[model samples]
Target chain A: MNNSASTSNGSTLHEIVRAEISRRITTGMYKPGDAITSIARLAEEFGVSSITVKRALSDLQSTGLLTSIPGKGIYVKDRFRLVCELDVGMSALGNIRSLGFQPKVQRISVTKERIEDVTLSVFNPPDRLLLCVRKVIYADEVPIVYESSFVPTNMSDKIVDEFGKRFIIDALKRYKVAVKEMSFIIDAAPASQEAQRVFSVPNSYPTLRRLYNLKTSAPTMSIVGIIESPFDRLACSVRPGSGRISKMNKKK
Target chain B: MNNSASTSNGSTLHEIVRAEISRRITTGMYKPGDAITSIARLAEEFGVSSITVKRALSDLQSTGLLTSIPGKGIYVKDRFRLVCELDVGMSALGNIRSLGFQPKVQRISVTKERIEDVTLSVFNPPDRLLLCVRKVIYADEVPIVYESSFVPTNMSDKIVDEFGKRFIIDALKRYKVAVKEMSFIIDAAPASQEAQRVFSVPNSYPTLRRLYNLKTSAPTMSIVGIIESPFDRLACSVRPGSGRISKMNKKK
Candidate 1:
């Protein structure tokens, strides 16, 4: 044995085993739908306790990277999830394009509305009505993001018609609303009915949501609005290099 | 009419109405469970179309701050959400304290394990096992965060035992691991079973997750770890000042 079972602290053993097995799946060493080695076999191969192998397999199960059958065995999860390296300043649209999918923006609605539920700043006139634009972004014709953008009401009409239908930041740039700072409030919630309808997912599908507050040179137009996307459709990764867009295997 | 409804662009009108009504509810002028003014009355008051008022109410309904009764009327949503202004550098524990909660860390387990699914850096030795620490952080005895930290296995055993039972940053400071840079990857997903067990929620609960990658003076000890929190237990807001510990109305 590489190390005595008694010497194993058991804390990190499963994670290592999990990672080794996860690597195999990621690299196609274990194809989707292929049954993985049994717990006893994995324990023997790694020279770890059976409990450690079970723990490792369980970790992978939680990640939706593998699944266990009642009597058969664990198999690579037969699903593809599209994960993007999304960040505050990075262009998600560009990222979609880089992922080999055609990106499109469909304008749902745009209107002048009063600001509600927003982070107040010195620049934003909390009492005044603002412009709100609602839209959906599509990757290869499948909706991925449902977004609402709020801006100053005084924005020019022509600009509103042509504003960043895809990005509020682009609209800010066009309006010459120089963004001095950009901060984020990130969270997740059950998909709203509107979100579900747009994404074609059922109610309560997990969603990734972000509220971006941009401090602009114009106090009145400092903040943008909110973005919501399906959890299965998007991934925000730690390192930019580590986020390679996976080929979405099916409609998520 | 104050202004002819026909003259209204209708785009921003409903949002303005929505914001005004939302403001009233937030300021407690309309208390929770208070049956708000009828749609016709609100429409007459605003001098816009009744459709606009309905739209406004529908917008508020989605926020969980208001509810619509089938036959009665639209009323203020009777719920409290604790929102915080979270940022990359702010001490979340301190934030919890500022919100009037006692923060405590309960160590689950610590072990030496191999690294996988991590951001590789010049400093991190991808081939070696590392120290892993798992723990839960509580706010007023309510489990809020489940975290796992990874560090070089070469760390002293004393350091591992004491290593940031609450924070990896603290351990890094003690070990004189000079951090050169820090980056983040953020995403959300359906709560894993372990998360459900920790948060005591049912399956399919949404969760917010983040991974932090740190570059330190020592190449082998670059990245730190991950943190997972139940979404309903946390509300990340746009401004730090806006984040205040809310009264726990009931167990979430």
Candidate 2:
């Protein structure tokens, strides 16, 4: 059983204002950690009453996009915008840098497993065993992405051995294993138990889950990456179109 | 306050098994509306015990990926995979068609308003009065997308007058209004009251929201499209890459 907040004509107006403010945040007009104009001033600018602006800002606060500090006024929270396109090959190290935050590998480990790793076998490993590389990438001090990528041992002996020590993307490039194909599945779901424990969020907190399947040209290998990030810690965004964007008709 | 179902030693194995099954559904190994083998069969195939398979299938069922019929058997639900590429600009019509479903415009209307439409003005319409084109696209019988796109009247008189009568993409093409640039924002948020009411889903049900901003040449107009779709009704998927995928380092 659930109840939606009362939505009438006034709510429609409230939504319009809230959506407008949200658009500014998403478009980077309100940069992370920037102060926002007072509600009364915003009211005058939008030509709406102060109540509308207050409601709009209040909604933003609830969504973790804006923060109202005690006596310090309101400011945009750093909802660190993450790359919407999953093809950021070396992004595990680059995403945080572009956002002006120090990147750190909070945790890293590698394990080799057999059929016991039914999950990794989806990569269709030719051999019965595969290598599992897990890493936790952080933005500044906060954990952002919890990733577990898999590669069949036969795909490349170098990748199986060096991925844990070196950047996984660098290992691929160094060994001349070119990724020819990739696919992504993006969804919004409750954070996994492991993510909840790692990120220390409440149970069932919403997360942006991205799974990528990569294919290599040499030795014909299959690699899989599973990335889970909480909504509060990441935002997926596209740059304002710089050039003509061909119609994106991606078949599932 | 919430409690995570106790995740113990067996839980990790359960997740691995569940994840592999999830990968299959997402990759279309099990297409929408396909029957799945019995839990016993899946257990044998994965070389796991029946209890592990049972828990994995139960988790998938709860997630709406697989559904069980009392007397019949488990089958894949119609997750209706939609385009992950929010640039599906015109795919409001094409997406369903590509999925082998008939698409119908459930509702179509146009309106012109001033500053009250702050949400529309994010497009930065040149005129005080902007044209808002709103439509609901349906796949077969279920409403899949609710879209509201705006165009400043001064940019294109034809668009303001004729968009309601013709396919929007066609109107843009016929008028030679080429989109020079575009950007997208994709996120998962609780279903809006409008979406919940329209889609007949629960309050706060998870929904995929995609907002797009389009820029055109010539008169230099700004266009914006806001789309809200329920997760149960639509999914964002990328096809297995056919050609090499360029590094997707999209700057927000």
Candidate 3:
């Protein structure tokens, strides 16, 4: 009937039907592959319309918890067993390695240049200097991450000359600068045309954007931004217990 | 010409062009808002086909680094400036709140049920007992997350009867079972027909799936799997600070 009022309170006949089936599946009352009660049957049991029951089933299907075959009943889908957390440390690298992922750097450009206010704010250099590097990192040669990073220019005058270097971190090591603290922010937005080519996604696809700060002590050393396609194709994992990086708080 | 190769590492002329532009962006040679080199100019400079240059520009656009306008050529897109992290704690709630999101839960069903092998493996109940709750949480009254959670049956007898009575965490607290640890796994897949209706997403839209493990003293208290629509709509932030839950590890 009028499901409008229930919308505000988060109660609806569709939700009721969906919840019933979900409870059965989670508690083992209805095992996977078990044929669920038909919409007609649920409509009668709940004393609601069949449309409501159908709506409820639809809610469960969207979450990937259920699958329906035309002319057949609904069933539960396979579930992933592992737990993953996104972090940046040796442990994070280890987790990726464990997943059998090979990280490859497709260097796009390396140049030394004057810092701008926006870039300077992220990588707070002591003087008017900065180095910028852009690359697309692939997992198993499948481009997944596009990154743009900025470093203090004065820290390494040789950065521009050393264009096409393999890894920026390795270059930093050559300059005897250790990365200490990092700040990160993540958001979602529509993919750009270039992103589509690298990730092989459609023009309208959405990507996860991650901006992070690389720091030595309290002052920021570098600012890096990465755009990941389709959001879920990339899984980041961090281990607990070893090779820990020193931590520092963000500047106010 | 003839850039195709059997192996995945084969570099096409388009890829090379993409690499060149990416390098310029990362090096600060082409700052944000700057007009990217024209397709004709790049094609001539690289001595490659215009098709190759076009493909490279399209790739960069999909990566969220470039924007193209009709008859106006391509330009660098504005970049966001926030340090993003994978948030696993209450900080996640804070981030969600900062977005002005209001969460509303609708109980789909509440039931007590027997344990089976599949449910046992996912939840890891302590004594063959379990209580199941199925819910759909909305943001701004829009259906976004669908969750099916399983709890120890004996831990909270008559849980199903408690429907529409209290908040989920509050009800669990009544059982003297505090959530000590949580684990999560995220993935992406195409949404189902049912999801299309609840989320108002068109068919074939990609969604994110998150699996959560709630525990007390290393024993599983509950297991929840959430299927979310417009998966990229919500931003995720993780803070790696000193906490009991922080001690847990993530595997990709």
Candidate 4:
């Protein structure tokens, strides 16, 4: 054993063992669901105290990579993958560049309608007119996000016809309305028939859905609601980076 | 029935049905985990076709409000009442206010360490010194986040002593280091022994672990890695609002 304390760094014996095992796991030497050696055996192998081996195993467990059963030894957890959260401002179109898969948008419809009581209550629009646009977003040609966006009616006449555009943020910018702030509510539920068709999940598959409110300096720009099936399969990452230029700067 | 075509305003039969059901669920008419009537029953109840009822149910399921079993009927999924994403930015400390519960930070240890090959490769510090701070953060006084942060040594001696500060973001800012960007890699694993103590979960509990990289013009901040027990209940809301932010923002 290279017992020479590598530098002045006094890494606990447990940390050293943990790092070695983590390397093996990340490198695919230990495949998913593989059983790690018994903690006692591992302790013997590493010439470390059993308490140290136990601590190392404990670290791996906390990272969601390992599972342990009572009386049974440790096993690797299934479907462990890193999720990266990317920040794309508040515009739906801003997310395109960072999406791991190519997203194709198919506009289902865009129409002007008298504001419903529910929507009116939610957006509290300055005016009673509303424009609703429905679209299906496909990732890798598979539909993953089914979205309906409600905008105030006076915004634009070309809203329905502009479905082929790659990003919605650009279109909103063209309308001279900038998305300044946004919020989201996410939940998991079962897939609807349309969601089943889009996500190719079983009819009974559960999904995660998010409702987003896009706001400018005005009351509200749009209410974008998305229906996603198999919510677990879709990884979400939320990282904050530099904010967009302030609305005042954009106006100038 | 209001057969006026304008009454529904081109909204799909599915949308109307979904809206009605969602209203009921959110209004507390239907409780979580309660089974909604079967498709046939709902169709008969609403005087709509079974296909329309199915579509609405599917929409609810896709939203994570409902779950369905192949052999059985559909039921509501558990609702997570509070979900907030922390952001990495100038206003990152604002995240504490967004959380449904107050966050309490407890510093466990502060130590100086020499950068060895493994530590060097992981942190890639410009200097050879590293400051380590270990802490646990609680939500509603329940320990949920156990973290260790490594800062470049030359930054300041205060980085080590400021361990007891309530907010790491504010502490870093006070030290004259601006956090420009943060990167996070999140995954699931089992809880470590230390995690089990802090999070108070059983050995079998799953955990969400994140490795966060806080950077400035130079990577001046630190790598803050946290292992949190798998939430027994998780809920998310992404909407345009003043008080809430995305979960993607909180890792750092």
For every prediction, compared with the true complex, DockQ reads: 0.19, 0.24, 0.09, 0.12
Each candidate's interface RMSD (Å, one decimal) is: 15.3, 5.5, 8.4, 11.4
Q: Sort the candidates on TM-score, descending order.
A: 2, 1, 3, 4
> What does DockQ come to for candidate 1?
0.19
Residue A187, model 3, lDDT? 45
Q: How far off is residue B127 in model 3, in Å?
A: 15
TM-score of each: 0.60, 0.61, 0.50, 0.45
Question: Candidate 3 residues A1-252, lDDT tens each?
Answer: 332332223255666566677777777876766777777877887778987887677656644456566688776744432223545331233444566777666777666655453432433444444466767765566566666666666544575333234344444544555556555444454554567667654434555555456565433455454435445345433322211211211112
Kindly report which residue stretches of model 2 are placed more than 4 angstroms away from their true locations once superposed.
Answer: A1-80, A83-86, A89-92, A108-129, A155-167, A202-204, A237-252, B1-78, B83-89, B108-129, B155-171, B237-252
Which tens-of-lDDT digit does each residue in B60-119 have in candidate 1? 653445667769988785553345543422236666776687878888888777766433
| Candidate 4: residue A223 Cα off by (Å) | 4.2
The digit string of per-residue lDDT tens for model 4 on B1-252 reads 233332233267766777777777777878887887788877877778998888678646534466677679888765543343433221222443464557677888877765442312433544545676778766666565676666666656665566455445556655655667665443333455677566544333444444456676544445444434333333333332333233222321
Error of 2 at B200 (Å): 2.8
lDDT of 2 by residue, A1-252 (tens): 012332234356667677777777778988888988878777887777898788678656645577776577788877544543444534556666765888777546677765343333334545556677877777787787787777776555556566654445556766777777766665666566678677755333456666667778876777776777766676455442332244443434
Poorly placed runs, candidate 1 (over 4 Å): A1-90, A115-128, A218-220, A237-252, B1-91, B114-128, B235-252
- Cα error, residue B226 of model 1, in Å, equals 1.6
lDDT (10s digit) by residue, model 1, range A1-252: 454343323347876687688778878989988999998998998988998898678656645567677688988855534565434222467667767878898888888777664433322545667788888888887677888777677777766765546566655555566666665666887776679678655334678877776666654455567788877667555332212111111111
Candidate 4's iRMSD: 11.4
The candidates, ranked best first by DockQ, are 2, 1, 4, 3
Please write out the lDDT profile of model 3 over residues B58-101, one tens digit for every residue.
75664546667769878876553222233222122233344466
